[model samples]
Target: VLCKIACMSRSRFYQSFKQKLDCTPLALQQQLRIENAAERLKAGESVSQVCFSLGYANLSHFNRRFQAQFNMPPSLYSRKNISH
Candidate 1:
């Protein structure tokens, strides 16, 4: 639907998106979700709240991805940033 609306083939859309953003759509989505989660966590929201609010269905998966992106668990990241 998005490709049709953009008047381009799916391949062209993906190519253009990658060229402009330097990341795949899924990668961009994950980065944005994690960044938003980090902000919410710093705003005093709980880890669970951030997880569900960001549409993650599994806590462990979210934790792994968050840790991979930020090099710490969300709880620790929140605490470390909040106390500074």
Candidate 2:
């Protein structure tokens, strides 16, 4: 849909997006989702709620991505933030 709106093929859009952003579209999406999820978690949302609300059906996958991005699981991150 975004590609259609931009009047470019998927591959072309990905190529241009990567060139401009220095990351692929999927990477950007994952980064954005993780960042938003982290914010919500810090704002006092439960990990499971944030995971599903962010459209991640697999809790393990969400945990791994969140851990990779922040070097800590969402639960730990949220707890640490709340303690501070």
- Residue 47 lDDT, candidate 1, scale 0-100: 96
lDDT, candidate 2, 1-84, per-residue tens: 778989999999988988999998789999999999988987899999999999999999999999999999999999988633
The residue-by-residue lDDT of candidate 1 on 1-84, one tens digit each, is 768988999999989989999998789989989999999998889999989988999999999999999999998998987733
Weakest ten-residue segment in model 1 by summed lDDT? 75-84
Candidate with top lDDT is 2
Q: All candidates' TM-scores?
A: 0.89, 0.89
Model 1 compared with the native: what TM-score? Answer: 0.89
Off by over 4 Å in 2: none
